[model samples]
Target: MSRRSEEKLAERADLMVEEEALRDLAAGGSGLVGLDGPGAGTAAKSAKAKSGGGRGGKEKDPARPRQPYVPARGWPGAGGGRVGYMDPPTMWRATTVQACGMWPFAAGSGSPMTGVPLGQHLFTGATVCGDPLNWFTRARYISNPSLFMLGMPGLGKSTLVNRMLIGLAATGVVPLVLGDLKPDYADTVRALGGQVISIGRGRGGINVLDPGAMGEAAARIGGDAGEVLKAEAHGRVLNMVAALITIVRGRPMDDHEQSVLSAVLHHLRERTPPGRAVLLPDVLRVLTEGPDRVRAVTLDRGSDTRYRDAVDPLHRSLLGILDGPLGDTFASETSTRIDANAPAVCIDISGIGEADTQLTAAAMLAAWSDGLGAVAASHALADAGLAPRRWFFTVLDELWRPLRAASGIVDRIDALTRLNRSLGLGDAKITHTLKDAEALGTDADRAKARGFVERAGMVVCAGLPKTEMEDLGKVVGLSRREIDLVSSWSSPPGWGVRGEDDEPPGRGRFLIKVGGRPGIPIKVAITDAERELHNTNTRWTTNEAAVERAAARIAREVARPAQEGPPPALAGGPAALALPGDPGFPAVEASAGGWTA
Candidate 1:
């Protein structure tokens, strides 16, 4: 009720009076309101009357009709509004303008609780989900540059790997399983698809393949099977000797020591007339030319002349046998072509000691990689003779450290990584700890594991204990949220993620990192159909096929009368039988005791 308040009230009253006059004038506003010039101002203000002014100070009727604004029933034109905000983010796929903050919906899942909204019909032919993105088709195993599967025991890794490989092989994709497994795995592989090697026992290796005018496999070995074996064995032996020396010395030998050993081995193989290779000729060539020569030239300068003299003769004899006898058998033998698109080739070195495992692992990995590389190269090769082959991921499971003896895995990783990509092959290596990986390098380099994980393009971490999770986080560059996903405390089948809508990463859940694309967590399809197609668990029932075939054959024969017509009938019906109580025909089912008879 102060002066300012009174003035505001007075002003409001005047405004109402003017509004009334304006309305009244508007009804028939043409005449008086159009007074000329100065007079018009006076006419316009005719209703600007205060509470009481001039003509009367007495209060007007309290309930006098007062003009009210129609559209003006809005905010008062007094002060400006204070800034305000919107509500919290509640629904997924909700609008951003009215949002509080968003939490990730379940990533790449179709579970009622976790499934994120999909666009529609992206995967045209896929039948699983109704998502428009067509995740099934787009995320298929074929589309990926490579697929990698890693799991703890009983997680069904090998089961799926073998099954899927077999199925693919049957498609004429060519499947070759080179791993440290007994005949059972091979048998299972064969049962699902392509032929398997019979090297172990009678199962026999793959039959000689018609490489279809592509002598690619033969070219690698130079001439025949013995040559290939010899080359592989030589590399393996050299690798083994290196590991043995490393184990004995507690360290890798210096360049000089290596040189001396090489010289001695070389001297024995070449200085004598018996040095002509009788077995693995290719291997003998590689050994004598580069390896032993380098050693002889370098180490002979020191006190290693005696070493060379002793080992040289035996080396030559072995090389000669490898060149002659060994080469002959392999030359006449045939080759087997397995699938070039397997997801894994498990190289189990369980029985071997840590030192020997290094040699075997290196040699085997090298061989598989070379084969895959050859396949891929053949495909991309511009030559008309070369057909591009589809290569897949080469995953190593149950990876063991070579007892601080073998050598730097970094070198192997580097070589493999280069070759893997060149041949369209991916490498997924599984190890228990970061330290274990670190130990595989000879130079005590810390970045060995880091370099590997970084180059892998995709790194999937599962069942990580807390401590190991922390350690992995440091090297893997995973964020706090991503680390949480990896170290999830939830039981199997839960998933955790960090990006847009994070959740617990669970069993059958995997995160893919494709080049520069965002990490996509996927709920893999583990259905029976998928398993049957990918892993080859579905067996062909010969009995059922045979039954159908037999029925059809029998029907056709019966309808046409295979005997040209019906057999002789009982001439006078039942009375025509010569024997008194003879049945015209015997039971076919029981005839001669079996169908064949």
Candidate 2:
């Protein structure tokens, strides 16, 4: 046959198959392919008869008894060609971006098999996996190794991180939990045979100013050896003290107060023994009588008085830290040291309950600083060609409290966030909300706080309420489709039969946005063994019930005293009264007959 005739025959064959399918469908048949039976053929013939057609009867010329009313069996038998369908040429109108997005499957676009295995991609069944450290190290990938995870509580945020950390640990990446407020990671850490440092008053201590770590940190940064080491030690101590004092005073440090703190740390660095830690008591004593007193000769009378004034308030603030709930947590030397090469370490701050945000922030700072120093030391030793590995991960769970403690504390956090690359640290900050940025004291602090999230290499965000999507989109640069998918991943408004035993959609599901790349929705898939070890889901359990009851009882106890009488004045003790007329530190008093004096 001619080529044109061959094409015409193929088209006829495809038409015949489609006609047979239509007939079967119209006759209340499934139209399923590859079926052969008497009932199917009868159904096809009956439908063709209803349509007033009988095996192309008009072309048959009334030949051979009209083929005994037999239906077409298959496409090749129905027509004359060997194969069934020959589809016509077709094209879809779409932009390059849209077309590229739709090739094969939407989720199959640009997902590489790198880093640790996360889970299956939402749209496509392809595996989606990436680590912040791996992405940061790759050329032109992510700029920073910091990451943020935001989700509602009990929606697998903690559980997901637990899985990721475990995966990273398996790959020789050490996971250090900077602050575990809920104390949920202890089981995972223990299961991995890692260390858990319980940080609280008297339960354990984390000396924020451990000279040994500070000295090692100095050695790592590569400076004029001992002097560089001492200067580094002084700076670390200064940062810790300034942040602590700011938290204690509920404000930023003034110039003279900052100057006094610097001087005191400098003096302590010079006077302390080689291996002694810089305790808060040492800082308090130096603040009271060291620099301002020694520098008295250089200052004129008014300046001297101002110096004395700043010194006393600074002294009281430092004194409060030495005497407050955090004193035992950070005053002495660290009882348990986080090894630089340990597979995992979890600093449990659950001992400091919700009532003490300040204590929680302080302990976090101490532990994080210590961990940073250790990691830096490891990196330095690697530089010196002595260490086995040079990377570590710092997981900051419940990160908001420390970020919102004070502006100075935010500065410290920014420093750590910026140094993530050089020190080989991948900081994964976990939080329930992003409002912690707005809770900062100043616009600058808020911007810095948000900038930390902005600079992250990846953000694993789960479901958020409708109201929060707009702001979250702005903060994280989520696309419209991404926001829609987030809503899809959220639980439906009402329930149905299929959903009765269905797990909440938001749990274990997350939108993973690699820096400036299309966000891939993924879930944290774990083995049964992993599920038991890293489970943080306390909801619908007896433990949850007990926690609720205890919280209620504590609330009642706290409210009963307030109901009985007015609050006592200066319950903050001398720290509230020792600001030396600084208006920033206001002192209130109760007067008789319900009047202010």
Candidate 3:
């Protein structure tokens, strides 16, 4: 019963089992059939096989039987196989305060879903809704209720503003497109059932002397508020007249002359009949006549010569406005005034050619005066409890034109930008580049003009040149990636096949930058209706069709014999002329006789 003797007996037992299993294998029998031992099951055999039978057959365990073959199964969802339905992941909304606590590990942020839905975010594909007033009043995202939009020409600056106009109008905010140089918003205003007041030569008139809605609003209220409004109306007229004179004279008026003009306007208003609008002619006539009020204000004591000499410049400037190129537009009585009840209104000044810088400048100033006067009147009535409170969305497009036209205009726009929030007005200022402000005449004017962009609640930019981005960066903070993204959009379009319309890379792409926060890049999406309503290329397309038609007509005329009789050179026979679109007719040149092949 010693330990060595017991081990020898166990070895002898293992040898006997091995001989039986090997003999059974040699007889072509199943080694695993009816196996009865400690390691005689399939699992024990599989484990031994996986261990390689103790590195060699000599050391193989006989008690464990061999395992049977079994094929491997494939994954059900692989190789385009059917898979069981999976429960979709759920998403829950939370405020920022709640989100910070609930999802403490999440990173990054997105534009808030507040204000007008302008377009989709460029990175996260989230819808971006933003504007100055909406973001300020609703979301408390920005402090200023004004927006400045800068972009290259033909880069959807006006289209973006039009989108805001359409959206804000739906929210019961009246839109006022003051001095639409390209008439970009006229269609939008009309589509919104708003009034489109055209001001140009032979189109319509806006007498700067006419108080517009302010006068009417002042007349309706009879308390101290009414007197305050009346005084405001007079100041508006005086300032308008002064602005016009500055535009015509190419310089700001002196205090003495301004006082004389102010006094004359007061006297004219007092003498004029109620319900009648004061015209520029009335202003000029009153200045020409040396009335007591005019003399008193001029400080000319019973000296008609000194009085006439003093008021001579003011008299000539008013007369110039009455008889100048803009006479038909600004000198006459008001033809059409903005309708406050309408959802939107635009002063269409596109009829005036852009080349006439002074006229454009004067008309734009007058339109601003008139538009803001109407807004002031609305507030007055609301304060008096006679009308419901109203909010206005004011758009100032081609802002540089007015600024460059008159240095004084900068002050007026500066005042408006500062007071927009208090006046219940949300305004957008649009221009080609920041240099437009920098190109102003005076240092003071340029400084004030630059403030327009600086004080904007938000800056919405489309494709802009790298140089412009540099200038813009000085006013607003922009990162390298944002700069590159914006500059890339300004790249020239690739050449396209004939008859294929090539769209600019940044046609509707915009970057909304508020303060130093991460920028929200968006690609404005326009509907078919909006595309039609906001088409700024109508002039180009129409001109192309017109040119094609003209070419065809010229070709027909040249191809046909002259009814009156051909010139002496072609009298012998009708000239052969290849019509447009004919084979080999790449172009036609006109000779003295007619269009040649």
In terms of lDDT, the best-performing candidate is 3
Candidates in order have lDDT scores of 0.41, 0.71, 0.82
**Candidate 3: residue pairs that collide:** none
lDDT of 1 by residue, 13-38 (tens): 54564565576556543222221312
What lDDT score is found at residue 163 in candidate 1?
37
Judging by TM-score against the true structure, name the best candidate.
Answer: 3
**CA lDDT, candidate 1, residue 171:** 35
Q: Scored by Cα lDDT, where does model 3 land?
A: 0.82
Task: Predict model 2's lDDT versus the native.
Answer: 0.71
Candidate structures ordered by lDDT, highest first: 3, 2, 1
Please write out the lDDT profile of model 3 over residues 109-162, one tens digit for every residue.
566778887887887766788888789899999998999998889888888888
Candidate 2 per-residue lDDT over residues 1-597, each given as its tens digit: 897797777677556666766776676765533435223645555656666665654332221121222333233444553444456677343445767756564434556567777777766657776778777775446788878988777677877777778878887888888778777788888888888888887689877666545476555555565456557666766777777777788776787677766766667777887656677777766645646444553243557566666467777777788787667776787788786556788888888878787887777777767777667666655665655765777787777777765456577678878877877778888887677678776889888988877777788888877556668888677788888777665664356667555567787788888666788888666678877776565544477777899999999999998789986787776566766456556656766667542
Q: Give each model a TM-score.
A: 0.43, 0.67, 0.74
Candidate 1 vs 2: which has more TM-score: 2
Better of 2 and 3 by TM-score: 3
For candidate 3, the TM-score is 0.74
